[model samples]
Target: MGGSFKTQREVNGLFELTDSARNNLKNNAYYNDDLAPTKLDERTWGTYHIAALWVGMSVCIPTYMMASGLMAQGLSWWQAILNIALGNLIVLIPMQLNSHAGTKYGIPYPVFARLSFGIKGAHIASIARAIVAAGWFGIQTWIGGGAINAALSIVSPAWGAWSAGIWVSFFAFWALNVWIAHKGPDAIKFMESWGAPILGVLSLSLMIWAVTAVTQMGGSVGDILNLPATYAPGGFWKIFLPGLTANIAFWATLALNIPDFSRYAKTQKDQFMGQLLGLPTTMAAFAFVGVFVTGATSIVYGEFLWDPVAVVANIGSPIAGLLGALGIAVATLTTNIAANVVAPANGISNLNPQKITYGMGAIITGVFGVVMMPWKLMETAGAYLFDWLGTYGLFLGPLAGMYVADYYIFRKKTLDLDDLFKGEESRYWYKNGINDKAIWTWVIAGIFPVLGKMVPALSFFSDNGWLIGFVVAMIVYPVLMKNDTSSLITPEEEEAMNEKVTG
Candidate 1:
């Protein structure tokens, strides 16, 4: 939570935003629970637990759908898996870099952004990051609804065909997401820890089922394993390059907002080892399952089945389909709320912390999820794969780059927590309340990418847009803010400031 709105904001030369009494409240931005530093008592998560978080998020329908979409575009199984693995590993660098701020300083991503983007200007990045999360929330909700509809068919075929039934299923799953998020991070952690293993086991079972179905159709296992590429060698790299970029975009949202989760780390080793052990391997392995099953579909059904929900429905037994749908629905639910709802919810709540609680932030995310009309995207999920995921990465990458350069280069891994909360004028206050340099840097870096996305002839910029933006921001921001020492609050001053107020 931030400062209150009832009082007149005081300005005492260099410390208008640092009023101990007036801004003590979490009013101006993020929720008190979200923005504040983690207390010694609440920092109990360890290496395995953090790994479980990634595992739970990684082994879900969207992760599978991404790989399957790549295969649909004509890449072989190895090509698709390689891209996912490589992308995850590349994203891990910035993920770890951003996580350092949270683990060391106990601040969320939005707060961390304030260091580079100014206290208020950070909203630009925060909200931009949230848009992707909102998009994800809608996509996952749509997937869950499809899963629910498939499960419902086992009960009554008529119930599954109604559009009203689909809406009801969507809302019900939406309600489940809201309920868990309302329960807070503890409930989320519990779900991730337990849900990940269950989903992993079920994926193996799904593989077995697919292989059996293919064999029963008199198809050889060798054909599925050695599924030929539909793309010519030259054509494969054309799609593979953008496909790789899309894969990076898959978890790029998390790479930027990771501090939200990393803030809970008990030790630096916990975050480091956990993400290293969990991210790429889980994505590659789960994606392999999707690749194999989709290939099996080609053998058994004479066409590819990219949608996992449809794969479950086509299992040829009502009972088996029901079981698969239930598993998928549960997996999607876990992934949706954990991966999609939490970050944006925190970001919106950060905009006005005093009034908007975490639950309200979550509600905001849910409402936008509906407004995005994710069902339309689902109808041709493959077509939007590059457009939806790769495009967002263009901006998010710059935000991540600025944070890394700001924290490691300009600030030297040090920050004044007291200065982060204030509003008057400090080193972080570049102009009024916004860090114009950081804002301009991000904007300039992202322009061509956004343009490239819109203009077909500039596809080179589109394919490498995120990486280009990241490099430009990384180089530009530090050069612009080189002489600033406003954030250089000494440790003793920090202690005195903390002593005057509550943590």
Candidate 2:
């Protein structure tokens, strides 16, 4: 009887172990098994590297285009800036919360997802994220190709030849990014360290040139700043709220996966400092520079222009155009590797935790990127692609809400960290490695928001669908899963789970 009790306890603990615990026990075979876990030298990534990533990611053509959109929406530059800052602040909250877990556990995002979604069901979330990443990868590559092509046009008016050359350059760089990603996390770390700073220097140089040109052309800074708003206000709720929600959702993809990077931090302090330095200070500064340069461009050209590539092309200097294209290409590659590659890698790894390694995940994601034909979608759909992706927030919002509610409200910050890894017949093995109640609540909560985004009549709430999904999940997941404590492992069981993880 005693032996049977001990065996049962062990089995229960295994079933309850969280995904990270499982990875630790399984020697991280699910992802990057060939690469031994290297205790991240946290000091290697200082505030500067963290800051640079935000700079590189945020201070680009897309950001400038988005800022232009805000300006077009009739918001004063100051108002637009304020709105973006607030939206980014909202994004930072979840990122910080998720990062805490990552810094503590040193696990990637997919592994972490298992804690909330179940080892098996986690794949659904992972695949969704991967799809998004793959799509962006192709889109960005295509955009970068266009920029390169534009620059080439100045050098040689032979349009077709230059276009072909531009695509070739884009693919070459794209292939290089893939190779770097395959070299594993270290390559990413190195790129993040250098890419942002280089891009910053280039951006600042452009800004300086623009400002100098404006001054030389007898335009005052005040004149430059007072550019007229282009967009008419539909209503406060329609305009302001939509902009706010779009800004938040714009960051949802990265915000959701912050833990993947944060887990490498040596300590929670490192994570906190990184976020503080990275998001508000670095990202805001980049945006400010973007606006400033863009404003100068408008002053010089007698029209509001948002795309940096367009701004450079309008500079009427072939050299400047070429340099601008080069900078954008480099920045795109950096973001593509860091954000796009990792998100999918985590997703694929989660799908078959025992079979897919990190390298395998990257290859799979890359293949998906090819199949998705992201470039064609971007060309056809344009900005609507971004708006369409807002529906994903319905699913992600609920997932995030449930995770947060489970950790803070229901579980009271306590976690079993064991049963997450166990096989069938284990407590968390609810109907074959899934929590149906959680799933049902998630699907239910996600539907209305998606409907709001999709259906014209229901569009009033379209902008705030993410928030709706979040609120619904927060309310429903706990209520539905209540007293179903079998899905969770106990603290004593966590010890046994830890032994397996550390073994």
Candidate 3:
């Protein structure tokens, strides 16, 4: 039973629960300090902060590898950059749509899902996001560790020569990431606000270095850049369609869980304008840098060096090596904490908000990251792009569609903030805290992508899994939701509930 609040307050379309309401909700199993809505004063992230967040997350090793990965699949340098731009542009629509709910309601992704997926059933979205985030957390940690190991190796010959040094660095870096994440969202915001500028400078410096090195080696950066496609196994569309899907899938997870960051945003315009200015442009620009640098690598080393850490390590000056190593470390750290840590920490905390604190959830996420053995996941460019990304995009894309449809079409962009925290007493608490309509809709939409992955005949569906899943869920969720009023509250009902809580 929810208690009456002493007063009502709304800021920039975000509802802030009064002290009375907060106290009443505090004892509920589903309610926890970490999972609660942000207060009016806490919503301080403006356009620059949100934009900087994207810049920090986008300029990572994975973003750096995106062009090289596509090139490995037989795309020319320009083709890869264009594909990355288009995919990011396509994904930005859903990213912004999902972000609306976060800014408007001041809720994280799991709590936002409660409107459509029900209370307990929201786990479907949260856990799915958590699984994907864990893998990414591991991959970034591994890359950061390699950078740290490289820097340490320069200082101490014995540490560099020791067979176990790399493992030592890996675990040490992993612990540091978990520790910093446990410090909470403010720590993350501080890192991103400060780290974005430094990363931008380092990325540009690397690109310039590549061009100068290639020229001095008496090889043409222009010639390497002009090189045509080397290995399109089936043809252009065969490589392209999947490459586009993989690129979209790269950030598809963020599309669903963006609220984790956007909840801190000050206004809808702040989040929207910030995301528009940040995500696509930074990704496209980074892809170009990656492609150009890799091209220069071919001229300087006579072999394609896809890994940026390896490229930085190859530079002879010990001081330059240290700086490059630190740059990679910082880039990986900023990305991992913002992109990988937040989703799972918040999602897993949704599981038992009473017992699992956000910091605890973050530590648990780190353990899961290690257990996933991300080294295996990064074995090859082909496996990373096609196998891992394509497979996950199959399910996540539909999730974005469902979240959009429920928020925009079915609910008309309205949510009762107080009821969202209730247990069996709430309208969102359908059928033992699960929405059968949403679960069934997700399964039905996901089946096609799953089949496509399994059956070679339906490989087109798998290749374009994210778009397929998104469209199917968009079409299906609305129809199912039309007749199912289980989660819907009429105007009268909403007014009454608001009065009850406020009185």
The best candidate by lDDT is: 3
Can you give the TM-score per candidate against the true fold?
0.91, 0.85, 0.95
Stronger candidate by lDDT (1 vs 3): 3
Clashes of each: 11, 12, 0
In terms of lDDT, the poorest run of 10 residues in model 3 is 494-503
Task: Give me the runs in candidate 1 sitting further than 4 Å from their true place.
Answer: 1-31, 490-503
In candidate 3, what are the lDDT values of residues 356-417, reduced to their tens digit? Answer: 99999899999999998877878888888888888888989889999999999999987777
Model 2 agreement with the true structure over 215-249: per-residue lDDT tens digits: 98998777768875555555545556667666676
- Sort by lDDT, top down from the best: 3, 1, 2
Q: Which is the better candidate, 2 or 3, if ranked by lDDT?
A: 3
Give a tens-digit lDDT track for model 1, residues 165-248: 888898899888878977887787677767776688779888998878878887777888899888876797678878877887
TM-score of 1: 0.91
